[model samples]
Every structure is written in C-alpha cells, then in structure tokens.
Target: MFRTALRTVLAHKARLLMTVLAVMLGVAFVSGTLVFTDTLGNAFNKQSAKSYKDVAVSVTTYYSDDDGADGKKQEPGLSPKVLDEIGAVDGVASVTPRVDGFAGVADPDGKLIGNGWSNTGTNFAPGENGKDPAYDFTEGTGPTEAGQVALDKDTASRGEYKVGGPVRVATNGPVKEYTLSGIFTTEDGAVNAGGSLVLFEPSVAQKLFLKPGYFQMANVTATPGASDTKIRGEIESLVPRDAEVQTGKQLADQQAADIERELSGINQMLLAFAAIALFVGIFLISNTFTMLVAQRTKELALLRAVGASRRQVKRSVMAEALIVGLVASTIGFVLGVGLAVGLRSAMGQFGAKVPAGPLMITPVAVAAAFGVGVVITLIAAWLPARRAAKIPPVAAMSSVHAVATMKSLVLRNSIGAVLTLIGAAGIIAGASMGKDGKFSIGAGAFFSLVGIIVLIPLLSRPIIALVQPLLNRLYGVAGKLAGQNAVRNPRRTGATASALAIGLTLVTGLTTVGVTLGTAIDKATTDNIKADYMITMAGGVGGLDESAVKALEKAPGVSAVSPQRASYLVIDGKDSSASAVTPGDIEQLLTLKTETGSLDSLSGDAIAV
Candidate 1:
C-alpha cells in the first residue's frame, strides 16, 4: 500500500506540488520563529555570564525600579563601613565597592552612543594588585586620579578618543573633560551594550554618581577552596540593612531570566503569525486532497474490486501525505535556519543587535517542526482518505461517487453556527470582565476564526450567485462559466478563497482596532497632560534630578516645567505608588478630574512636593 502511494505521488508530481508548498511554508515559519528566539536567548545567556566574570559574589542594594529615583535624590548605598565588615569575613579575599550610573557621550554626529540608554559611568576601584578584574586594560593602566577616565575599547575606537586624549564625560550634572588615562575592553553588560563607557577614579565616581564614601554595590572575591554559598552566608550578616547578598551563579541566572523576559513578547508575536499561517494552510491542504481523491475515484474503486481492503486504500492515501510532510519538513528546517541567521544579521545592520553567539537549534525545536508538519498534513488528508476508502466498486465503474450529502451540509453548517454564536457571546462577556478576561478573549477569537472558516463553504453558493450577474455583464460567457464552476463546488471555492478572506479580515480588524485605540489613548493623554511637552528619564531608571529639571526650565522660551517624582510607600499600611508633584504642577501641568484639597495647604511627602 505504501509502495502504491509512493508510486501514485511520483506519477502526478504537479498535482501534489501545491500541497508540498503549503506544508513547507507553514513548517518553515514555525521553525524560523523557534530558531530566532532560541538564538536570542542563547546570545543573552552568554552576555549575562560574561558580565559576572571572575566575581564570586555580588552584594547589591535591594531596590525596585522606583527605588532608583530615591537613589538619585539621596542614594541608599551600601556604606564603606559595611564594605569593611564584609571584607573581614572568614572566606572573603577582597571586596571592590563600585558605583554605577548613566553617563551619556555623543559621537561627532551628536547622538548618544552605547545601547543609547546603557552608556555607563562606573568607578574604577582596583584591588591591591592594581587591577580591576572586570576590566582588561589594552592601552593603559587604570585611571588613578580625579582628572583621569578610562573608556571601553569599542567606544574609544568609535569616538576616536585614545589614551592621553581629552575624553569628555557626563553624568546627570555636567560634561567634564578628563585626560583619557586608559582604554580597556570588558564583558560587562553595563559597558559593552553597544554604548560608550567612562571609568573614573573611585573618589570622582562616588562624588559624581552618589554621595561621597558610599558605594552602589560591592563585588566580593572569595579565597581559594572557599564555597561561594558559605561566603555569601557569612557576608549576609555583615552587609548593611538595605543590602542583598547573592552568589555569582544566582546573579547570572537572574540576569538571564530578565533578558529572556524582554525577548518573550517578540518571540510570542512571531510564533502567533506562524500558527496563523499553518492553520490557514489546513483548508488549502484539505481542498487539494479532496480534488485528488475525486480525480482518482475510479482507481480507488478498481483496487477495491481487486480484493484490496478498505483499510489498505485509506493507508495508501495517508502514506502519500506522510511522504510529502517528511520531504517538506526537511526542506523547511534548513530554510528556517537560514532565515534565522538572515534575521540576526538584518537586525544588527539596523542597530538592534544582540551579543554575538552561535545559532541555537534545540531538540525541542527540531521535534516540534517535524511533529507539527506531519500531523497537520495527516489531519488535512484524513477526510479524503476516508472517502476514498468507502468508494464503491460498482458506483465508480458507472462514474458516480458520494463525497457529501444535504444531511452532512446541514450538520456542518449547524456546528459552525453554534461555535460562531458562542464565540460572539464570549467576546462580549470577556470585555466586560476587565483584566481577568484574557483567556476568554483569546479563546473567543480562536473559536470565532475557526467557526467562520468552517462556515465559508455554506456561504460560498449565495456569495457566488450574487457575483454571477456582475461577472456575466463584465466578461460574458467566460466569467459566467467561471462563476458557475465556483458555485458548483462550494467546498473547493471556499477553501481557495479562505486564505485571502482570512488575511483581509484579520488585517482590517487589527488596523481598525489599533487606530481606534491609538486615538483614544492620544485623546486621554492630551486631556490629562495640560503641558505642551513632558520630560522623562531616558530609560526610566531614575527620576529627573534637580540639575535636569533646572536645565529644562532654563531652556529658551520654556513656560512652566514640573518634575514628577515617583515614590513607593505604605499609605495606611497598604503599599502604594505615589507621584510627588507640587501644587504648581497640579495647577499648570496636569488636568485632574477632581481636586479635593485646597491648593494653598495641600502637601505631599518627600522630595519637596
């Protein structure tokens, strides 16, 4: 039966060619999404590992994103006293206290470089060995004094700033020109994020980024034969109240997880498009198989007449589908890998590059590619195979066959109508249910799409009849005959049209919704914000410092400038995220729905609000 199926496919290569193409494209899209996502994840993992090179443990101030705003006001750093206590631990060999903050540098074109928001300024605190393990100096030794700064090699090379040249560096305050004391390269994410780096003397960085004598975090190096866990435990007791101790492996894992989370949305979106393509291909595959089965009705009947079992006939048909799936999947996998590499390179060229790493092809991606491809093909061919098996020898000999009846049509249409109604109701109810309705909304959309596709065959006859008159007027006999042929095989017409129909429907629906939502959001933002322009931190890492606020307010022709500082606090013993702004801000910058308190007396906590 398998040999017969193989011969049959080989005999009419042109007939099965469309089926192969459909399956191949579906598999290719799915496999490509997996490969690209995996590659991104792998690249980030390598970067995260590199960022923590040679560090035994990382002791950091435990703070949320909002906490960083507080840092800008008055940094809650691990004090130098705590650093001394941690360094005195039994297994601790050394401790390097580091302060980090955003430090932007413009290229000759006046654009901020290095993962734009990731341009870093950090303190260079070399151990007794006169070297910081984090940075490997290539041109000169570490910067030792207030007037010296070290630049990362990549950033230095890009900006044409060499050792001993004046390198201008900026913090939130002002740009200071310093002698480029050294140039180094490092694997740290803070330095290598396609952005420039400026390493200042320890005293200088501390004075610039935070208050003097305080460190943002301390990197601890353990003695030989010391377990990281043991040292972490010992140091935990010694560190400051606000500090959190974690081993190097824990820090690496956390960083990797954070990076994966950022990539998740893109991965899911691409995978969704892949799923849609595969789903739409199902109808195309089914229609192709149905046509094949109808054309080979006589052959199938002849096999049955020759004493071949019904099961054998069905198996033969399915075997052909299986072969097509295998061939298509093999080709698809290769193409998908190529697609991933191209996508990576394209993104890099456009400046959204990830850290360079080898392309990842996990076993799961391979299994999913072949499994989804073969299973989908089998499913699409199932009904046609069953019909071919049931073909009566006598009926086929007389050139008569039964593919569907009025009863089957009624049953199919009824099922589709029920699903469509259910989906509509689910969508409406889901919308009213607020944030908890995500599952309902997603399920409703899926069911609605499937139901509509199923009902397309029933809709075809009426739609074709309406178009027939227009067609006859436009092109006379050829158009009229084409319309009649489409109406005669509604299932075939529906299958052929579904792909285009679904594509148009989805695009139109999404565009309409997106435009409407965007307009509404625009309206809301415009209404809420009375100011002409809103100022925000580049990466939302911290609130605008006083210097930043003053800089904006001092701009020519500026009317009113208000700085809104976010603070997380416990209000009446419940956690609350508050925005601290002055009475002038409430009056001039924002249009609130209601203002209960008297503007003269109203006051808010911290940061002079």
Candidate 2:
C-alpha cells in the first residue's frame, strides 16, 4: 500500500503542488520565528556580558513600588552620599557612578541622530587613568569639564560631529551647547543597542540630565584577588535600606532575561500568524484530498474487486499525505533559516540593536515544524481517506460519478442550522461578559465559520444564480459559461468557494474592526481634547520633568498648561490605578460631566467618589 501510495503521489505532482505549497508556507513561518528568536537572544547575551566585563558589583535602588500608570518604572535616584558609602565598602577597588538619561541630539540638518534605543550620559568618574573600561577613546580624550562632551564613533559619523565641533543637546530642560571634546567607542563599538551614545562631564550631566545630588547607578570593582561574592556582600551591608547590591554576573543575567522577555513577544506574534496560515492550509488540503478521492473512486473500487481490503485502501491515502508532509517540511525548514537572516536585518533597520551572529536552529524547532505539518495533513485527509475505503466492489462496474443523496443533504443542513444557532448564542453571551470573554468568542467564531462552510453546498446555487446575470453582463459569453459551469456541480464548486470565503471573512472582520477603532479615535479627539496642541515625549519611558513643565508654562504664546501624574497602587490586595490633576484648571482644559457634584467643589486631598 505504501509503495502504491508513493507512485500515486509521484504521478499526481502537478495536482498536489498547491497542497505542498500550503504546508511549506506554514512550516516556514514556525521555523523562521524560532530561528530569529534564538539569534537575537544570543546577540543580546553576548553584548550584555561585554557591557559588564569590568564591574565586580553594582549598587542601585530596589523598587518595591509597581510601575506607574504609564507602564514604566520610575528610576530610583541614588544620592551622592550613597555613592560615597558604596565606594568605602570593604574590598571595593574603584567606583564609577553612571549619570544616564535621554538626551535628544540633532545632526547638522536638524534631523534626530538616534535609532530611539540609544543611551546618552556620562561616567561621573572615568577611572584613575582617565579612561572608563566600558568605553575607549577613538579620536580624542574623554570629557573632563562642564562645557565638554564625548560622542560614540557611530553617532559622531552619523551626526557629522568632529573632535572640536560644537553640538546642541536637549534634555527635558532647555537645549544647551557643548563642545564635542572627543569620540569614543564602547567594547562592541555598537553600544546603546545600535542607538546613538553621547557622554558629557559629570557636573554638566548632573545639571542637565538628572536632578542635583542624584545618580542612576554606581558600578564597583573589587580589589585584585578579592572575590566578587565577598565584595557584593560587603557592599550590600553598607548601602542604604532602599538600595541593593548585585554581583556583576547577576546584573548581566538579569539584563539578558529582560531582553529575552521583550523579544519573546515578537516571536509569539509571528507564531500566531503562522498558526493562521496553517489553519487556512487545512481547508486547502481537505478540499484537494476530497477531489482526489472522488476522481480515483473507480480505481479504488477495482482494487477492492481484486481482493484488496478497505483498510489497505485507507492506508494508501494516508501514506500519500505523510510523504507530502515530509518533503514540504524539510524544504520549509531550509527556507525558514534564510527568512530568519532577513528578519534580523529588517529589525536592525527598525532601530533594534541586533548583534551580528550565526543563526541558531534548535532541535525542538525542527521537531515542531515536522510534527505540526504531518499531523495537520493526516487529520485533514482522514475523512476523504475513509470515504475512499467505503467504495463498494460493484462501483467498478459503473462509470458514472456518485451524487449527494436527499438523506445526506437533510442531515447536513440540520447539523449546520443547530451549530449556527449555538455559535450565535455563544458570541452574544461572550460579548456581554467583557474582557474575560476571549475564549468564548474564539470558540464561537470557529464554530460559526465551520457551520457556514457546512451550509455552502445548499447556499452556493442560489447565490451564484443571483450573481450570474451581473457576471454575464460584465464579461459577456465567457462569464455566462463560467457561471453555468460553477453551478453545475454545487458540491465541488461550494467546497472551493468556501475555502476562499473563509479567508475573505477573516480579512473583512479585521478591516471592519480597524475602521471602527479609527472612527472612535477621531470622535474622542474631537469631543474630549480641548487643547490646540499637546506636548508629550516620543518614548513613554520617563515622565516629563516638573522643571520642563514650569519652563513650558512661561513660554511665549502658551496659555494654561496642566500636568497630570499617574501611578499604580495595590488597593485591598488588588492592583488599582490613580491619576492626579490640578483641581482649579481641570474645568477649563477638560469637559467634565458630573451626575451629582460640581467640578468647582473639588479641593486638595478631596475624594471624588
């Protein structure tokens, strides 16, 4: 049976090409996502290790508070006193306080010179020899005075900055001018994850980037022959209660883990699209197998007449699917490796600091691709295989094709109607239940789609009949003939059309949702937003500084500007959120509709509820 199945597959290669292509596309998606994830993870891990090469211990604040309502964690501002204490810890060799913050820089053309993932700041104390281990000077010396700054090699080249060039830097405060004192290179020469890197003098950075007496973090190096574990332990005891100490390796591992978590989301999103492609492949595979079985009915009946058992005939069909899956999956895996390489470059262009590395192909990815392809193909081919096995030996004596019976039609229509009703009920109930109703909605959609497919044979003829006149008018004789041929075999025509309809339905649903969301956004902006213009940060990392808000309030042509603060809190063991705004300006800048109390009655520490 297997040999016969192999021969049949070889003979019908042209007819089965579409099925092969469908399976290959799905498997390629699965393999490409896995490979891309593995590659990015390796790159980040390598870079993180190099970033912390010189540090033995790191001291920073430990935040017990949840991230604010903007979904960003507030950086703990460490005082200069804490840095001195960490430096005085037993076994500490050297300490480098890092003053880091976002500083927007522009090229000569006034265009931003960053990939958005760039880091900008200064090393408060560049080591004893005036060189930071994390950074090496490529063109000139490190910044040592208030008006001087250093740029990374990539940033300098891209922004057209030279050793003596004057550059403007903008933080949350007003833009300031500084001399480009030097150009430096990090360990990898591509630090900040492919983003721009700018360094300034400690005093200048503290004044412009951070508040007075505050540092982002301090890196500690253990004395020669001192154990990192011992240094970390001693540093922890000296640090304040709000701060924590970690070994260099621990910090590196944590950074790698964070990167992995972020990248995993992208991998999962790609996998979801792959699953959709595979689902569509299932319909194509099933349709192809059904037609194949019908065309080969007489051949199967003749084998039965020659004493071949029904079980043997069924096995032959399944064997064919297995071979097709194996060939398609093997080719797909190879194609996927190439796709992964391309995706890495694409991500880099989007401002991701993807390190150049070899592609990583894990055993699990290969197994999953082949396993899913084979399983789906076999499952889709099962019904058609069974139908072929049911062909009686007497069928060999007849040349006519079998047609659907009245009893089968009645049974199918009845099941379809029941399924449609149940699916509609589930959708309604799910819609009424809010955020936790995802599973119900998904299951309902699946059932509804299947039910619609089941009714296609019954609905196809009438739908085509109604559209036939229009098609004929548009294309004349050719269109009329095509329409006539489509309705001639309703079962075959419906099967093909249903496959297309399912894909179209999903696309239409997504389009409608997108359009509705867009319209709602426009309505909300028109009705709720009262300001002529709003000032916001490009990245939602840190909040706009109070100093920046005050500066803006005094600017020319500016009316009243309101600052809103939001944070998350645990209330009664459940996560809750709160937002604060000025009580006096709230009415002027916003449209508040109160059911009971007036907006004017609000005051300090007042509870609106």
Candidate 3:
C-alpha cells in the first residue's frame, strides 16, 4: 500500500506541487518566527550579562504610582545622597553614580545619528580603578573638561567626527557644542542596540544632561572575596526606603526576562499569520485530495476487487500526504533560516539593534514545523481518503459520475442557508459585546465563511449565467466554452472559487474597517482639538520640560501654547487614561461639548469626568 502510494505521488508530481507549496509557505512562517525570536533573545541575553559584568550590586530608585502620560512607567531618579550611604556599607568595594539621559548628535548632513533603540548618553563617574568598564577609548582620552565629549567609535565614524573636531550634542536642556575629546568602543563594540553613546565630564553631564542632584542608578562593586548576595544585603540595609537594591545577576536576569516577554508577543503575532495561511491551505489540500480521489475512482475500486482492504486504501492516501508534508517541511525549514536572517536585516534598518549573533534553530522549532504540516495535511485528507476506501468494486466497470443529484444539491443549499443565518446572528451579537467579543466574532466569521463556501455550488450557476453573455461578447468562443465548462462541474468550480473568495472577503473586510476607523479618528480629532498647532516629542519617552514650553510660548508669531500631560490609570477595574490641561487654556485649545457641566467649572482640584 505504501509503495503504491509513493508511486502515485511520484506520478502526480505536478498536481501535488501546489499542495507542497501551500504547506511550505505556512511551515516557513512558523520556522522563521521561531528562529528569529530565538536569535534575538540570545543576543539580548548576552548583552544583559555583559552589561552587568563589573557591577556586583545595583541600587536604584523605585516608582509606585509613577505611570506617565504615555502609559509607560517612568523610572524616577535616585537622590545622589543615597550613594554615600551605599558606599559606606560593609562589603561594598566601590560605588559609581551614573547619570543617564537621551542625547543625539547630528551627522555632517544634519541627520540624527541615533535611533529609539540606541542608548546615547554620558556616564557621570569612572569606576574605582579609574576606568569605565562599559567603555574603552580607541583614540585620545575620556572627556575631562566641560567643553570636551567622547563618542563611541561607530558614532564618530558614522557622523564623521574626528578627535579635536567640534561636535554638536542635543539633550533635554539645550544643544551644546563640544570638542570631540576621544572615540571609544563599548564592551560589546556594537552600537548599544543601534543607539549611540557620548561621554562627558561628571559636572558637565550632571548639569547639561541629567536632572539636578539626581542619578539614574548607582553601581556598587563588592570587595574582593565578598559574595554578591552579601554585598546586596549590606547595600539594601543602608539604602533609602525609596531605593531598591539588587545583585548584578538579578538585574541581568530581569533585563533578559523583559526582552523575552516582549519577543514572545511578537512571536505570537507572527504565528497568527502563519495559522491563517495554514487554515487557507487546509481547503486547498482537501479540495486537491478530493479531486485526486475522484480521478482514481476506478483504480481504487479495482484494488478493492483485488482483495485490498478498505483500511489499506485509506492508509495509502495518508501515506502520500505524509511524504509530501515531510519533504515540504524540510525544505521550508531551510528557507525559513534564510528568511530569519533577512528579517533581522530588515529590523536593523528600522533601528532594532539586534546584536550580531549566529542564527539559532532549536529542536522544538524543527519538530513543530514538521508536526504541524503533517498533522494538517493528514486531517485535511481524512474525509477524502475515507471516500476513496468506500468506493464499490462493482462501480469499477461502470461509467464515471461527476454531477451532483437534485436531492443532494437541495439538501446542501438548505444546510448552508441555516448556517449562514446562525453565523450572521453570531456576528451581530459579537459586535454588540464590544472588546470582550473577539472569540464570538471569530467563531461567527468562521461559520459564515464555511456556510458561504457550502452554498457556492448553487450560487455559482446563476452568477456564471449572468456573466456568460459578457464573457462570450468579450472573448467569443473561448469565453462561451469556459463559462459552459464552469457551470458543468459545480463542485469543482465552487471549490476553486471559494478558496479565492475567502481570502478576498477577509482582505476587503479589514480594509473597509480600517478606512472607516481612520475616517472616524480624523473627524474626532478635528472636532475635539481647537489648537492651531501642537508640538510633540518624536519618542513619547519624556515630555517637553517647562523650559521648552516657555521657549515655545516666547517664539515669534506664536499666539498661545498649552502643555498637556496624560497618564494611564486603572478606573473601575478597567485600564484607562486621563489628561491634565491648564484650566484657562482648556476652552481655548479644545472644543468641549458639555452635557451637564460647563468647561469653565473645571478647576485644579476638580475633573470634568
């Protein structure tokens, strides 16, 4: 049976090729996502470990209710005074206070040289050994004066900034010019995640980059022979209540875990697309197998007459699917590795600083790719295989039958109509249920699509008949013959057209929803906002400081400016956001349509809602 199945597969290679391609595409997506995530996660893990190599313990400020306007929790800076206490702890070898902030330098063409993923900043103090463990200078020395700055080697080369050359650096404070004192390389020697780093004197960094009297974090090294656990304990005892102390390994592990969590979300998103592709492939596989079984009707009946059991016939069909799936999955896995590398390069261009690392393909990824492909193909072919086994031996001598009976057609159309009504009702119910109705809507859509596909044989005849005249007029003999042939085998024509129609339906539905949603947003924005212009930071990290607001207000030709701060909050067990605006400017900057209360009633301590 297996040999016969293999021969059949080999003989129908051209027909089976389409099935192979469909499985390959889906398996490629699954394998590519797994490889990409594994590679990226490994790189981030290495970076996290290297980042904390020198620090035995870290002391940082903790935030409780510090969710910022952008819905992200803001890391509050620790008071520099806490550094003295941490340094005085027993087992603490050395304490280095670090001040970190975003800083960008322009290239010769005035293009910003850093990306959102890149961390560009200056360290406030060198390590106890009089060297910064994070950086090593490739040329000249670290910055020693307020007017001098040291840039990472990559940034220097990319921006065409040489030693002693004047460079402009932009920070939250203001843009300042400094002499390029040195070009340095970080511990990993790659732009920290595609970001740039600039070093400056402690005083200069504190004054120009960081908030006054605040440090981002303090790195504490343990004394020689001191355990990090003991050092962490000692620091924790001395550190202020607002600050949290963690061992270096704990910090590194936490960073790695965070990156993995984020990557997991991306992995799921990619796998969703893979699932859709595979779902569509199921129809193609089932349809192709059905057609193959029909073509081999006589051959299957003859085998049964020759004493082959029904089980053997079914097994043969399954064996054919198994071979196709195995071969296609193996090829897909290899193509997926290349796809992963391509995706990495594309991500890099978009400023995802994935560290250079070898592509990682795990055993689980390979197993999953093959397992999913084989399982899906076997499941899709199961019904068709059963039909092949049920073929009567007496029918082998009779003529082939291709048309459906009137009774079967009526029954199919009735079932399809009922299913379509049920599906439509479910869709309406799901839509009315709001955000929690995703599953309902998805189920509804599935049923609706299946129902529509089932009814296609009945629907296609009329649709084809209506278009037959046009097709005939357009192409004469070829068009008329094509139309007649299409209406002849309703099942085959319906199956082929349903596959394409399903994909188009989904695409059109999504596009319609997207356009409608976009238009609604535009209308809302125009109706709500009364401001002439709004200034926003490119990255929604830190908002514009008061100085920036004042500067904007003082700009010539600017009539008025308002600073609005928004923050995320848990309201009535639901995640929501609130915004703060100046009371006086609220009416001027916004068109508030009050139902019960006037906008003028809003005060510093009172909220409209």
Candidate 4:
C-alpha cells in the first residue's frame, strides 16, 4: 500500500507540489502566530525575573478621577509619607523609597544621545545587594551625590561614555554635568525600559524631579520567610484604595495576558487567510482526483471482474489519500518552523520583544494541521473514488464524454432563476439600510449572498448562454469551441465561479470595512481635537517639569499652549487613562458634551460637566 501511494503521488508531481505548497502555507501561519505569542510571554517572564528581585507588595498613587479641568490630583507622584506608611506594616524588613526620573543622556560632546524613556516611575524593590535590580553597576559605583550618575553598559558603550568621564545630561531641570560613575546591564539587557539611568540619592532625585516632599515609588522588601498574604493585607490597610498594589509575579502575568489579548484578533485574521488557501487547495485536489479516476475507469472494472470487492477498491483509493496527507503534513511542519523563525527575527528589528523560548508545537497544533490535510483529501477524493468503485465491467469501455449526457440545462433553469432573483433582492435590500439598520439588515443580506453562492452553478449557465450567441457571431472556430467548453460542464464552471466568489467576498468585505473604520477614526480625531496645534511638555506620558512646557511655548508655532497632567486611571478594573488641563485649555482642545456645567466654568467641583 505504501509503495502504491508513493507511486501514485510520484506519477503526478505537479499536483503533489501544489497540494504541499498550500498545506505548507497554512501550517506556517499557525506556527508563526503560536511562536509570536509564546515569545512575548517568555520575554516578559524572563525580564520580570531579571529586573525585580522578590518584590512581594507595592503601593503607588494613581488618579482617582478623569476631570481634565482640575490639575490637583492629576500628576501622580508618590509621597514619602506613603513610603513610611508601607514600611510601618508588619513583616516589612526595609523600605527603599526611590524617586525615579528619566532624562536623555548625552556624551560630553552632546551630539548623539539616549532618549529618556521610563515606565511612568513604576516601583521596583531592592535586590539582594540593597540596590535596584534594574540597574547594574559596571563602572565606579552607584549614585551617591546630586551630580553623580550610573549608566547602563549598552548606553554607555553606544555613546563611548566610560567611568569617571564627565557627561552632560539635559532634562526639564538645569542641564546638569555629571560624572559617569558606573555602567551596568540587566539580564535581559536588550532594551532599557527605564531609559538611561542617571540615578541620584533620594534627596537629589526629589530635587531633580521637582517634587518637594514626594517620591516617585518605593520598593518594599519583607523579612526573610515572611508571609506575603499577611504583608499584602497590612500594606493595603496603610495605602489609599486608589493606589495600585501588585506583586512582581502578578505584574508579569498581567503584562503577558495584556499582550495575548492584543494579538488574539490578529491571529484570527491570519487564520482566515490560511483557511482560504486551504479551500482553494481542496478544489485543485478534487480536480486531480476526478481526472485520475476518469483515466483509471477500465482498470477499476478489471479489478472488480477479478473478484476484488468494491469495498477493497474503495479502501485502496482512501489509503492512498491517507498516505499523501501524512507525508505532506510532515514536510509542511518542518517548513513552518523555519518560516516562524524568520518572522520572529524580522519583528525583533522593529523593537518587538519576542519571548526567548523554543517553539512549542502543542499536540493541538499538530492535530489540527494533520486533520485539515486528511479532511480536505477525503472530501476531494470522495466522489471520484465512489464512481471508480461503482464502475461495471461492461461500462469500462464507455467513451470519455459519456458522462456529459446525464447533465442537462432544464434542472439548472428551475433552481438558477429563483436563486438569481433572490440574490438580487438581498443586495438591493442590504444597500437600502441606514447605519442603524445595517446590523440587522445585513443578516438578511448575508443569507441572500449565501443563496447566490449556492446558485452560482445555475446562474453561471446564463453567462454561458450569453457567451454562446456572442461567440457564435464573433468567430468561426475558436468561438464555437469556447461556447462548447462553457456549456459542456455546468457544474465545473459553477464550482470554479463559486470559489472565486468566496475569495472576492472576503477581499471586498475587508477592504470596505478597513476604509470605513479608518474614515470613522479620522473623523472622530478631527472632531475631538479642536486645537490648531498641540504644544505638549517634553514628556507627556512620562512626567514633565514646568521648564519643558516653557520650551514648548517658545517654539515657532506661536500659539497658546496647555500643560497636561496625567495619571493611571483604573476605571472598573480596566486601565483607561485621564489627563488634566486648565479649564480654559480644556475648552479650546476638547469639545465637552456637558451634563451639568459648562467647561469654561469648571471650578472646585469634582465632576466636570
């Protein structure tokens, strides 16, 4: 049986190649999406482990409300008192209150520099050596004074800043001169999320950050063998309800989950395209099987005449399909792994942190790929295989075109005309519906489309019918042959048209929806952002001091500007954000749909209407 299957596939090299290509593409897509998701998950896990050491509890201030008019609670800076409260909790060993601020690091020459990018001053606990795990000291020592700084090895290497070298740094504050004390690298040092760290003592950090009595975050370390559950409860009791408390492991898991949810839709879209490719492959295989059976008609009859049961003959053809499916799947799986690796490398260049883990080929992925191959093969070969088994010895010598007589135009007319009319009605009705009616009305429209797809075989006869008269008038030899080709196999013509129609349906739907959605977002952005131009502080999502806003106001735009204050806004368990602006600036940039009060008159009231 194995030799017979091999011979059969080898006999038709072109058909086998086409089938393998299609299966390879589908498997590659599945492999890429799975690997991409796994990569992100592993990267986050490894990064979190290397960046933080045993951080059991953290409490940080966040915005309580979203009223942009009030700037009171907008800028979320952790106060030192909050740190003291957390440290006072039972089971707490020591509290290291850190004031983190990001600034672009320039070499002494001040040409190329590091962009100051930080994670909005999220807290990290002290490591085993009473230092933050995020920054590794490679040069002189950690920051001990206001003007001294520590630099990551990557940033220091890139800019040629070495130990004891005087480096000038620019931030919202004065352009301070600091000696590069040390260079360090984290375990996952591919990216410096905390930016080029010019760390300072807590007092210096407070002064540089422009927070008089506040700290950005505090890293809490519990006593050895302390119960985290009890420590968490005691910490929560000290901090306000609005403050965020999360363990290191919990944050890492949440980050991974967040990335997965974002990529879920993208994977679905890729799967849809892969399915289309597989669908097309099914047609090609079916055509190949049909031709093979047609040529083997006499051979099948001989087998039957030689006392071979119909069941035995059917099994042989099916066993051949099984063999092809298995071999193709194995080859496709190997190709898919290579494709996934290429895709991951390309994405990495664009700064996507893929998880560094071996490709996890789950049993489900293997099962799905093999199952798809088997199912497509079985369905494609079913009709031809059945016909081969049913061929009688006397009918073995029938003419090649004998099957054509059994198909007629009468049956097509009865079903074709009705479906065409119904499809036309659906398209018309669907087009008539307004925006509000589109959802409900579109369902009926989709049903109509289904009808059109089903009746393409019948409806296509009309196109053939039209082509015949035109062809008969247009040419003598070619036209007659073309007309005969169209009219001879109504089912085959319809099947081909239906397949094309499915592909176009997906294409047209996606294009239309993409354009419509893009237009909608553009309109929304235009309507909401009423400013002629925006003048933001140097750091908007990151903390920006007043000096940065002053520089923006001096820019050539020469327009009035607004200062923005933002904080983490956890509304109903979803992390949305809120920004604070002056009431007058809010009136200019944002079009307020007020429920109670005017935007111009917003004052001490918590609710901005």
Task: Put the candidates in TM-score order, highest first.
Answer: 1, 3, 2, 4
Question: Which RMSD values do the candidates have, in order?
Answer: 4.0, 4.7, 4.6, 6.3
Q: Would you give me the overall lDDT of model 3? A: 0.81
lDDT of 3 by residue, 552-598 (tens): 87899877677888876798899888888877677778887778977
- Candidate 3 segments whose C-alpha is farther than 4 A from its true place: 63-85, 88-90, 109-111, 115-120, 187-191, 208-214, 401-414, 427-446, 475-481, 565-588, 594-609
Q: Is candidate 3 or candidate 4 better by lDDT?
A: 3
Q: Model 1: what TM-score?
A: 0.89
Q: TM-score of every model? A: 0.89, 0.86, 0.87, 0.74
Candidate 2 lDDT, tens digit per residue, 406-496? Answer: 8988898889877877788778888999888878887888788888788888788889889999998999999999988887766777778
Candidate number that wins on TM-score, 2 or 3: 3
| Residue 317 displacement in candidate 1 (angstroms) | 0.9
Where does model 2 exceed 4 Å of error?
A: 62-91, 115-119, 187-191, 209-214, 223-225, 400-409, 427-446, 468-491, 543-559, 565-588, 593-609
lDDT for each of the candidates?
Answer: 0.82, 0.79, 0.81, 0.64
Most TM-score-accurate candidate: 1
Q: Per-residue lDDT for 91-135 in model 4, tens only?
A: 888776665554666555764343334412212334458676555
**Candidates, ranked, lDDT:** 1, 3, 2, 4
